[model samples]
Target: MTQESSRTPPVQDQAAPVSGEGAQAFTRAQVEELFLNAAREGDADLLTRFLAAGMDPNLRAEKGYTPLILATYNGHAQAAAVLLAHGAQPDLQDEKGATALAGVAFKGDVALARQLLDAGASVDVPNAVGRTPLMFAVMFGREPMARLLLEAGASPTLRDGEGLSAVDLAQRQGNTALAQDIRHAAQG
Candidate 1:
């Protein structure tokens, strides 16, 4: 009996090569803990192993932090990349309703924000306080990130739950330059 000749499948379609009996010994909770730690430590290799083992890239840890949330918030670009590539949900909010983009915004990470945007993160995802990424950037004086978000279609006039817009936050934060920039962008 002849079998089908094409045994080689796409690498990602298969469970990645895991070695040793120890690989099978972890309990689900242990695996969960490892994913969270890997995200926090920026361990891309360990992250890949878990992802290839069919772990949910969006699995939430304590305080409802997903691997993507933890990785990006910690400024782990490579780990965040891996998570996004493995199908992490860019819009998943934590228990506090903060999206990964919202967290990255306050950090002044323009490149990381671009990455998140490229990965389909919404530019205007509001948190529990109804603050969008643009508001966070403006309030934190991340002028460049705020500009990037505006160029990406974040509404400068968007009001948070506290009835403050990005411009309002920028002014309140004492960043007149950013407020001017935001106003100009809005008018244009």
Candidate 2:
């Protein structure tokens, strides 16, 4: 058995005292703030320790952004990975219906976007305005992010509330190359 397995105690204790507080729990808002800070600071070690200490991995901020979403938005790939491993839902959306993938795409962080996708983030999840990650990437002129989202199964043909597809948004932004790429993805 590995060291970690060896440290596992046999299930015999009837009632071991809970390590931290017993019945008195912090309010959901306070817990959310703590997790949000951990995510925003990119403190993977602190986040992991918090999770290990019985903190909920799915805790969300006031705006409905979970720790995983905030971590990805802040470019904390390691924190995001740790959260995912600890049962953070990759497809959870914020108040605006924007997923972590969409946040990373808007920031033009192709690597982070790839990481989110690999962690099971939805490429086609639409925001409040029916804008997918691809649409956000195109609208923001993030060509690299747009290409990455396309490769990861984002549909260029999906239209937003404005009746504009990702390609259309790219064209509106005057990004001809990105528009071309979106068109090619739609063709495929």
Candidate 3:
């Protein structure tokens, strides 16, 4: 896409608005680009407007990244809140089979993870490799996130495609103590 072509079409004219040109109407590509940019930038107000105007909250990008995924992955709590309130599916997976909850756990955004959990996202939701949010958190040394997931009922004993549970992954990442902590937490 050219730089000049990347700009959104004018929302309106000062007086007489052109036909088929306004806030509610847009080409499919323009709508996709607009939503992707808005979500990525955490533009809550813009997202509210787009959603109010009947934009699909779950529209996915070429990589199967929905607006909710982008907003949460980019750490936009308000933007993500708006999308979720507008009916964005919290469990919608990207092309890599990563859900919003799993992404937030990997990114270590506990607040975002809580929001997703409240939105009914599965705590044990897995990626393509069957690595749950707990596994991602433990593997990346996100103790706070791992704790939250464990509290949310994420299965520490669940294994990934490589047969690594949260504890196993922590150990592989050289966090033997973290692995033990995960084990202890799961037990108690």
Candidate 4:
């Protein structure tokens, strides 16, 4: 059969094209290791110095975890906040598609989750299995995070690849109360 008329798909003429290579070039393993160390140690001054020296605030390790993610995971809230102020992509996902918000949510750190949210993380960005931050919060029975995500406009009805919604995940995790709360938020 004759091929359909050859036509280029419409490119979204929106934001400027991101220079992936240029961005990736600045993110070296050595810098990431140092940054992660500083974050783990909660050395805000050192972390700031490194960022000032042109080290990417969102540099990801081979495991796909970013500095912001590691900082929050390690309970370095201030460091994570500093990184956000330095242009770190709060929504940057690891190799497993887990964003900083998802990481903090799993840890039940409501404050860090809020920081990531305020930093402009997308509440709807799903992980590799389609689990959003809200899903993680609900699954972990983090009531505060669930409420925060709801207040931040997270959709409780959003489903993962397996058709599991946030409420469903909460129920599966034996959190009936959270499932009810999510349902209410979704309705609102």
Candidate 5:
């Protein structure tokens, strides 16, 4: 058997003291792992269990990605909605200062983006590099996402750290169609 398969599971013996400090700490770690894993794997049921068990809705993984951000990055709309329902802040940024909306824009998940907007996420928030969600959407040719962000008040005129607006970035990326769309949105 593989080493992982050969390992024994933790005992749930009620006869033993559940309140032991070591046991309690181990259980807490396990619960945290479960919460992080649930977010990464898009396991809504496990996420619900952890949240109901008092796990923080805003808990971040080792890489600083919150449960909502993880779910949004993974395109787990249901899991993301669950996190939002449990008081998770939609605008919380990860280590890179990119929020869940940015991940949704990168992944071209219009539904997730809509959910984030409904939850009051800011469309104009920039990442560490000053690239807003609209810039990401345009650069990545996520036309629908670009439109959504525009509707949500993403400033196409806002420049990134490179001093390029979403239109300029889109044109530089050879996304002429997206550039045109951005221009139209800006003029309207």
Candidate 6:
């Protein structure tokens, strides 16, 4: 396979290459953990290699964090891009039901969030707590992230499980200016 090939068979569809004839077989869980670790460490090359080797790009860790989620949480844009190119599902939620977009929002990473959006990630998918990416941004005082999410069509009127909108969360967090800005954007 060429170095640029992004799509590959799922891990179960292919046999992992062994270094030698007598080498012990690696379980699927071990491979998944390796993939997740590579994502968390920002090792784009390792991710590429894994994908090339037919390891599933969408594998989740013990906490249900996909490679894309781990990469975004660690600010590894390159790794994220690699995962996306390899068909990683950006909307898959972790244990907390937080998508990769939410991770970027918490990190205040507009660029990473943009990458996810461009790859068809939903801007309005909420976590287990019903907190959308916009709410996460607002709660964390991530103005740029909130702005980007708004521009990408995040619903400002959507409320969390607690029935608090992003603007309300912003206000509760003492971000008056950002709350006003979000309110205006929501209204406009």
lDDT of each: 0.85, 0.80, 0.84, 0.78, 0.83, 0.86
Q: Of models 3 and 6, which has the larger lDDT?
A: 6
Compute the lDDT of residue 7 as modeled in candidate 3: 44
How many clashing residue pairs appear in each of the predictions shown?
Answer: 0, 0, 0, 0, 0, 0
Q: Model 6: per-residue lDDT, tens digit, 18-64?
A: 34343334546666767788899999988898888887887867778
Which is the better candidate, 2 or 5, if ranked by TM-score? Answer: 5
Instruction: Give stretches of model 2 more than 4 Å off.
Output: 1-31
TM-score of each: 0.86, 0.83, 0.85, 0.80, 0.84, 0.85
- Superposed by TM-score, candidate 1 places the C-alpha of residue 52 at a distance from the truth, in angstroms, of 0.7
lDDT tens digits, residue span 6-31, model 3: 34444442344344432343455666
Query: Which portions of model 5 show Cα errors greater than 4 Å?
Result: 1-27
Candidate 1 residue-wise lDDT, 1-188, digit = tens: 11221111112222343335332234456657777898988999878877886789999898989999899999999999999999999999999899999989999899889999999999998998899999999888888999999999999988999999999998999999889999998898
Select the stronger candidate by TM-score from 2 and 4: 2
Instruction: Kindly list the per-residue Cα lDDT of model 2 for residues 1-188, writing each as its tens digit.
Output: 44533222122223332234333234445544666798888889878867886778887677888898889889998998899999988888899999888898889999888887887788899999999988888888888888888888888898989898887888889998888887887787
What's the C-alpha lDDT at position 118 in model 3?
94
Question: Runs in model 1 with CA error above 4 Å?
Answer: 1-24
The superposed Cα distance between candidate 4 and the true structure at residue 173, in angstroms, equals 2.7
- Per-residue lDDT value at 158 in model 6: 97
What are the C-alpha RMSDs, in order, of all predicted structures?
7.6, 6.7, 5.8, 14.3, 5.8, 4.7
In terms of lDDT, model 6 sits at 0.86
What's the ranking of the predictions by lDDT, best on top?
6, 1, 3, 5, 2, 4
- Cα-based lDDT at residue 13, candidate 6: 22
